[model samples]
Target: MTIFDKFDQLAAARQALEENCGDFFNMVVDDIISATEAVVNGRRMILAGSNNYLGLSFDSDCIEAACEATRQAGTGTTGSRMANGTFSGHVALEKELAQFFKRRHAIVFSTGYIANLAMLSTLVGPDEIILLDADCHASIYDGCRLGKAEIIRFRHNDINDLEKRLKRLAKRNTNILVVVEGLYSMLGDRAPLSDIAAVKRKYGAYLLVDEAHSLGVLGENGRGLAEEAGVEDEADFIVGTFSKSLGAIGGFCVSNHQQLDLVRYASRPYVFTASSSPGVIASTRKALSILHTRPELRRRLWDNANMLYQKLQDLGFSLGPEPSPIVAVRQQDKEEALAIWNALVQHGVYVNLVLPPATPDGGALLRCSMSAGHTAEQIEHIGQAFAAAHRTDQAAQTG
Candidate 1:
């Protein structure tokens, strides 16, 4: 009887969770003190869930840049980029990003999601096919849908599976677009870009890598997994977000192809959505500079990630394969996952509580993302809290 009838399953599931946990999805951090800590429910908690990898959100330079731009340009951009919203900062940032990636073109979007939507949807024609990783972010899937392209999903991080699909399309004359993430948000595992790139080359397909999670967390210059994996030349397009490593809110696509500029006119997301605010663009530019100048931040970020990952694994906690900034602790069921997540919060530690369907394997996850701002002591305390939370959950189940 209603347009929302399709959400019956979602509504029932949410209703069940609300009955058990009283709105766990609507958690609020009353005060965020820094990149690594926040105040929740009158208690200060270490923040392990936020994706502020380089912890540049509170950087003095970035804050100053944002303030200065805000003072000059006022608040929001009232029109889309195609209209009156194009500012000098926006254009400058795009040029800087293109230079940073050594690409011929760079186009900014309102968000990382929009970046994917703009590029994936606009770049492919109706005659093209999209070969995407099954575990790709929702934005990528949505973009493919928007383009109405024939979407074929390969197994997660399975290069062999991708090759199998590519081989099947060997005789097709349609354009092939293979999309994968630099670092998957859930498990933090990276795609085998070198092998995947080879497969793409064999099939004459274009490769696009989303570096949303990996930016500022990998590579010597923080260009992401493409640089670290030595496949920058192989990847035809790179999509990134200022929200993750740059600690601002925006998305971008960079490519050496001269034709990338044409997407600016063709992409609806880019043409319709209002461009990023001046303050955001300014701060992102400054943050990008910081990311390139201070490689030490990346080192600290990895140190924090390694410490937490090793300690959690030693405690017999099931974690995602491979050690990266993202560390997801798997739970046996939804109930246990919620219990442990609640216990962790009660112990003054905040991490993401991922439930079924949203999670990668139809299970629950205690997902933790590391930040360079987290001190050694703080990381140790987080490990201890996880141990205590696990013990508390186990005791409750046995009792």
Candidate 2:
């Protein structure tokens, strides 16, 4: 028997998709013009799928910084930080992140997934317990599995469920860690951090907020949902990524707790993985500066999101919980989702087509993420494309 025989079910599913949907897995972007425009399959398309929130990917300053860093520090860091990967840039970036978040310590990781993995896995032990949100990102779930802590899940965004679980655990003397996200990526909904923080405080549990999707998109200075919800002081750790708002590749965890710096010694993911490249660090630093200095970018992003969301809703399409940067259209089924997705692409638009198991509650999603770089005209064009696609789907159904 083949060792890979267990993946036959998945392989068959892929084959069926490709046969029916014209190679959905093999999408290739021929060129990227900007944060909101790209060339795919030899056609220029409006990009509504990329999560480049602040749209600093094409900023002149960030590009210049990345190029200069590549020239000075070479291409990559060849080893893990625990070995030889700790460069001056890495140290400087960590310090800057600590200052930016007003935290006592900050630790950088190769990627956001690794950041969550390192922090979640290393913070708790067998004697402790982890309370997780059911709808958290996969990285959080993996981190929970890597750790020795007993894991428990509460309903997604249900503060009452969380408090009930905390009350039940009140009699136990075990340490507790509560994990949640600042902004849930799939739904583009902000967490009720104030309420969650209260529950954590009542239970005397550590609260960790993963701000991967919310950083640079919330709060007065774009710190995240914790800051927006006025619960930053209550959160034990604020974890985020540079890839989204910062428009680069890296991740960081900041905390008021001085002991957070010690996670480097315990986290296998951080200890074993190679550090982020100097170019990434440089670009990210520049992006961070731009993110702070340019509040107009956030305003534009929200405006674009609101416009498109209103248009889609007016066209009779069901959307995610609220109007944020991310706008997802929940479909009747996988077939309907794929049909609309393909139609949009055919009409010179590109959005994410998320399938079952990957989507929440086994639903299919045509996810659209807005960038600050998107112009008002581009947003209107996208709305038209979506409306047209929906009309096409309706006509096909009736015919």
- Please report the candidate that would top TM-score against the real structure: 2
Q: What would the per-residue lDDT of candidate 1 be over residues 227-311, giving only the tens digit for each residue? A: 9999998899999999988999999999999998899999999999999999999999999999888999999999999999999
Model 1 ranges off by over 4 Å: 1-6
In candidate 1, what residue range of length 10 has the lowest lDDT sum? 18-27
CA error at residue 232 for candidate 2, angstroms: 0.5
Candidate 2 residue-wise lDDT at 296: 93
> What's the residue-level lDDT of 214 in candidate 1?
90
Which pairs clash in the backbone of model 1? none
Alpha carbon lDDT of each predicted model: 0.92, 0.91
